[model samples]
Target chain A: MSQIKPKSIRQVRAQWDGLFWTTMSVFGVFYLALIIAMLVADFRFTNWSDMTSLLSDARVRFSIWLSLISCTIAAILSLWVAIPTGFLLARLGSESMTQRLGQRSPGCRRLFNWARYFIDTLLDIPIVLPPLVVGISLLVLFQTPVGRWFDQRTGDLFASLGYAGIRGITYEIPAVILAQFTVAAAFAIRTMRNTFEQIDDRPERVAITLGASHYQAFSLVALPQAWRGIVAAFTLAWARSLGEFGPILIFAGTARMKTEVLSTTVYLNFQFGNLRGAVSASLILVTLAIIVLVLTRLITLGGSSNKGVIV
Target chain B: MISVQQLLLRQGDFELSQISFEIPSNAYAILMGATGSGKTTLLESICGLRAIAGGKILMDGDEITRTPPAQRQIGYVPQDSSLFPTMKVHRQIAFGMEVRGFSQTERNQRVEELASSLEITAILDRYPRRLSGGERQRVALARALSFRPRLLCLDEPLSALDGDTRNNLTKLLKKIQQSESVTVLHITHNLEEGIQLGTDHFRLEKGQVRAVVGKDQGGKNTA
Candidate 1:
């Protein structure tokens, strides 16, 4: 028998490294291949004629328009809330807070810490909850006496403003926007918070010391630096709104040409055995998602390396 | 004159107790401390960025302990010269005046004056990210002095520079201090820096601050 030579440490290490990388690549490529397969399946199932046919349908066109309009409105509202909420959360646990709370009793400090944690967890509830559950919760909430009272007030106000056909918020066109905002705003808030955190707080502090108020410092120093993050947050919110189906299906109810967005259009077509239409709609969403992803990447890469958006 | 009396500050488990110091008007005071000695904390407390547990800060005999930072009219240049990355040098220097509702003409004039004085007029239109380290420090200094604050606080403004740049900036700092006649409290770790620029010297150790007499007086402590 020929004597076998022992493997050198370097050789063994190289072999192990190769095994590790191959295993990792297997798992990574598997997911990527699955995504590609999904796209391929979607494309193979739907032809260009399917797209043109769907576009020809007034209801489908309305769905596309609703999707664009609702997602845009949801994104704008999300940004309105996200910017302030994110800034507050980013500054909440900062060193300045420590100094501010240092003079208080330990109990007070503990209470403040608990409050911060509680608020943070509370904000994350929408992001973590099941999409269907969020819709159900909104439905239930609107059924409550307080919700009904507010809804009645808003309905009367809209009537006074000459939108005589306008009704309450549940299962209406507004419901789609509300449902999308409920979920998308949470993601936007998270993105904005991370964006603010990545930026140096020292500049804001310096601004304050230079005779700028907190609002001035934030608007002038922090807000200007956070534009890329804003873009990322807006794109994420829009993409998320575009894909939001479960909440809309439950809360908004696919009322064709009124509350039916693209997501619901896909489902409505599938329910009616229109596989071609459903697949085409899904392809449209997929294309939009790809565009959003590319845009987010470009924005992130174009940003300053030190304070790029977390998304 | 700027004075911090019996100051107490806390961050997490770290505390600086009964810290007290005073810098005379137009004095170039240097505060020397070890790393993590709460030097920045003390500076921030004085600037109203950080709250103090028990202290009264007086600037020109006015009690400003509870006063907001903006109203305190104190210019602060933090370590790393935290310039606004989005704004060009001109806007960075004009930020304070702009916020205070200065006219466009006045803002332009002030920005131009500070840029000329700081020798950063060449980079006026350039954003901070494009500037060199020394240029950043100069821009920060210019921004701080733009509003002609009565007191200027610098946190290790020269620590990040090389030997030649550090020496040059040190000389510039002295020249600016004299020309502006603004009281300054400069934080540094280099004793040579303290000796070269400081008319009043203080050292922070173990969260306590004590005055260090000048070399002419044998470097004794007035703690």
Candidate 2:
């Protein structure tokens, strides 16, 4: 056996401090260039004054309001659905249920793995598919018999809820929100499931022995332990919803003071040759997104450092 | 309090065959065995955590081989303490009661008494992560006993402790078992612990019991 010499203190320190800063600086330059391009191509500091004016526009107000409401609904829906999906994936990840199932029937393991891969591929499908394709697909639903039936039933419910008739594409805010959820939820579930996977399963087992049923163990024990990861998933999903362009544009067309979200408003204003109006909306959207991202990053970092259960 | 008759478990390469054992009510039985022995498996079978391919288990004269671990009225302290780190000492001790639907007042009272008795009262608010190894074991014991289980199964409970802590805990455990008269099936590979606390001893060797014909021949048998 050979005795390998250890690195000197200086050598170890150089690897830690020197390589770390160099790697960070390289990525920092890339981020800075991206930000600079956004500023130069869209809005410079000179257009700052126009931001408040754009904020006062009725269409702009509606765009902001629509963005807020739709994203809020999408975020809430994504969290609600993703938590259970993530938890189940994490819990079942280790179980030989598939193995046992596979034994009972040959090709069962292959079928189970194929199904898991198929679902995983579907999740990534939303990520890669163009927003326009999403929008067009959603619009095609309106042309179907099922779509017509849904429209009539929903219109009746809206009427009973004290709203006027929801005729055609003119009243499809909920559809647009759902479209966002379909895409956003995939990313949310993927991230959350990864986080849940990192947690040990022993805690959940202990909870069960302590008298909790399976659901009780999950809700009280596993969920709280994985809360930080779930929060990170939520923030990332919310950001995705905020920046959505394709589905919202196609499914919920750009109508002034109607379906005008921040992204759609920017696009519409740009087409009208209202460069300043476009720039102002773009500027606000960018600013709002930056603020949101920073705030969420802070919250996520805070959550990462948090120990034990919230309760 | 607990009895097993012809319990058999087989999993591919490993097999436990026709294992039978009985512990008198209120007796402390230490399952002494070498590594690869079926000591842990036997305990798991009794608690209904593992299914026996063939056998019958009875708790208080009721056949409970098919019963789930949670419904078995048998509390198990796993080898690693297995405390829920997210829960405070107080909540951890009271969790068994909460699961059984005990009222808040009764649960809290039991928790208080157990904490004081176990000398874990000051650490009630602390998480399991902060506790020492011995403290964790004590909390695990308290949590198990708090439910007033029909039996207590300690699966190498002191194996994770340091030398001094293991010795101290062995004494503490013996005191608790005698006073509470909790039917105990304590598993250990340590000969010293087996002798110190065992009212009855069952030695397992490769899925089979090396039955005690007499004390003179006890230490010589091998599977």
Candidate 3:
């Protein structure tokens, strides 16, 4: 390792510091300018009459509502599966558990390592695989014998609840929700896993010695401290779901008033040579996505003040 | 009374072999060792927090070597106090009781009693982040003492405090031991603490642990 002399207090601002900031900021602005320039182009492309006409359509209203409702639902459902999965992943190799299990045979430890690898691979699928592939995968699953059996029972249950008109996920509206969940849940898990990792395990161990079972300690001591993280994960997942076009389009198909969310609405309009309607719909989604991203940043800022579960 | 016989623990590159000690009922036993000599590891083993490859740990004439921490009836206070930052002092102290199924009235009364004894009655409503180091230690102590465990395992309980705070807490530890008549296994690197408080002295040297006397018990050369 090369040892560099420490700079004097008077020379705190070095030549390298100025060059570093200038180079990084230029690169940052280059990426940021792309989004700003594209939005500006959208504004220039569509006229006031075209924008007004697009918004007046019943299909546009339904698409916006569908996107908002489905994304929010997917976000909430993702947390239910994500929290425990994230917690387990975050706490897997903590000192207490590892040391306690140190006496186990070599085969057991190796198996434990493999189990962790398997879980991580499973979690990475929706994120690493293309959105269209996720859609195709779900579509392919429904054609299998076991998948068909489960869908038949589920379809009957939905029919009993008067959602027969909605169609029982023969690649229908519910497929939009399934597709969003597949992708959004991976984001939720990543967010929550990082959140849980930030909390110290000492307090949880202390709670255990104080007569709390593992579940009680986690729920009472650990979970309460992760409140901000839960909100962040949900919102980020919802925001990610809002931009899901390829998956929902392939899995659910872009039928207006049925499976037409904002992203798909833009695609459908563009396919039909309705460029004004496409641009208008795209701008609305872009605006909504920017708002969701800003909200995520604000929530993160609010959470930064909390000191976690340890003093 | 608590007893450890031929305890063997291995963690990564470090190993403790054939370590043994006994602390009679209500006795204050101090275990002294250098930084990496396995004093804390042994304490954790007694508390069932660490896996022991070969050993027998008996508390009050019953073998509890493999028992889980929650069922071991051992109160532990780590080096930094490890108080839950999200909780108020009152709730932190009452948590053990809550877990042990104590009623609200019982929990409140016990918290009041421990807080008064530990001289932290004024800061009961404050969070751990708001409390000073001494105050946090007091809350950790109150919490550990909440369920009235038969054995108390303290890992350098006063190591983090300043000189004045250390003296005050040392006095409080003595006072609590006298009042509660609880068996204690305290690990410390301080000689003054061992001499001032211990009725029995054990020291770990080159991964082997045995009892020692007076002036040389906590010395660096003992390792």
Candidate 4:
């Protein structure tokens, strides 16, 4: 009787384990199925002819070129600021501010802590805000008196640099880049900050002790180690910039080919009831995103597996 | 000679106060302390990695308390050997020289010399991740000494190695210290290892430093 009871318990335990795994698999596969369904729907809504027609359209071609150029520029600019900002944040945020400040008065230490907290929160504002809210805020900001004055000064500066006819940044091509950068740079900075945090700072300290200056240590030791992170950040920013639509719409406007981008082209086609054209443009973006993902993986894998050469 | 006087350091609630010590030039000095006793902190302060609240650090009668780490001419190897992961062994060894604007020929010559002396010539082109624990320590040692800093600070460099490797490295350390004629301030928790390599010994306990007098010296404090 006892032996029979034990066997029955074993059977029940196995059944429970099976049920648990089945539940987990159902949850996991649900998301995968949804993504696959989306791709299938996109493919079904458009044909090769629609894709060809979209490519042949000059407006679509202009949108494609502008998307590429603006996204690339925004990504470059994001990296330019993100690298240093990320490094500083990683260093400062990782170490105790009290220790770095050293034996200061309580008031001073409190002030420093508040400042650090404020800056960190400020940096995260764009990330947490809704995309449409970001667009609205930027639109409202440019209409302010101070913003208008600054825009005029920058316009004059650009004119002096031989870029005539750029009266202001609002509703212009530069606004597209600016709007994309406003949000895309935030993501790049966050990615890079995480990257730098993951890396040990001991090598840079060792480099300094070995008579390498701060800049030398950063460039030689830290930067080389961070190459994969840099690539990831750039690709992420580029991808985010490519898909940015809300801010560009509100800030730069549609304007046909002047400030139009791939994302806006998709939106415009959909608004005009050109479902096939919209799906085709979305497919183009999906294809580009896949290419970037593959390239990033290849570059990172190449760096990791390369045995003889330094990255 | 390296000297510290009344060094006061505070991190959060932990503090090390009124610490004073000195090691003669070319001596292998070992610092012994329990975990969290601030041995690493003191080493970092001397290396200019940590800010000292109130203290004077002098090397060869010149005060370098305010000097930047690059100008301090100290070579530091942390507990994990903290090698640059992206650089080949040769490049790691040559990094300091390259950054300091040494000619390519000079950098090459120094790297070769350090690699040969450290018995790491076979692994010059390999990245640090491929190295075993002992090899990593040896490479880190080579890199630190490549630029010929006046002082070498090693924080538990052999702690992570196996017993056999640890014994081998202790002998190698002694041999290299003598051959290179560089002053060393090594931190270790192992008493026997400290005695084996150290010409001068100091112990940190409860935030204060005291010279560890050997039996041969009749228990007289030297610093």
Q: Provide TM-scores for the models.
A: 0.94, 0.85, 0.93, 0.91
Q: Which candidate is the best by lDDT?
A: 1
Question: Residue by residue across A163-221, what tens digits does model 2's lDDT show?
Answer: 75445342377766777787888888887787777766666666666667888878777
In model 1, which runs have C-alpha deviations exceeding 4 angstroms? Answer: A1-7, A306-310, B216-219
Q: What lDDT score goes with residue A253 in model 4?
A: 90
Candidates ranked by DockQ, best first?
1, 4, 3, 2
Candidate with maximal TM-score: 1
Q: Going through the candidates in order, what fraction of the true interface contacts does each contain?
A: 0.91, 0.28, 0.70, 0.77
Off by over 4 Å in 3: A1-13, A47-49, A105-107, A302-311, B219-223
State the weakest 10-residue window (summed lDDT) of model 4 chain A. A302-311
Tens-digit lDDT track for model 3 on B165-191?
A: 999999999999989889889999899
Q: Report the C-alpha lDDT of model 1 over B1-223, residue by residue, as the tens digit.
A: 8888988887768899988888999999988888999988888888889877887899999999999999998999988899999998988999888888889999999888878777889999998879999999999999999889999999999999999999999999999999888999999988888888999999898888888886443246877
Model 2 Cα shift for residue B60 (angstroms): 3.2
Model 2 segments more than 4 A misplaced: A1-46, A95-115, A165-171, A302-311, B6-17, B32-45, B50-54, B209-223
Using DockQ as the measure, name the better of candidate 2 and candidate 3. 3
Quality of candidate 4 docking, DockQ:
0.72
Candidate 4 lDDT, B1-223, residue by residue in tens = 9998888997767789999999899999988889999999889888988887888999999999989988898888999998999899999988878877899999999888888888889999999999999999999999888889899999999999999999999999999999999999999988878888999988888898889888242134555
Give the worst 10-residue stretch by lDDT in candidate 1 chain A.
Answer: A302-311
lDDT score at residue A175, model 2, on the 0-100 scale: 67
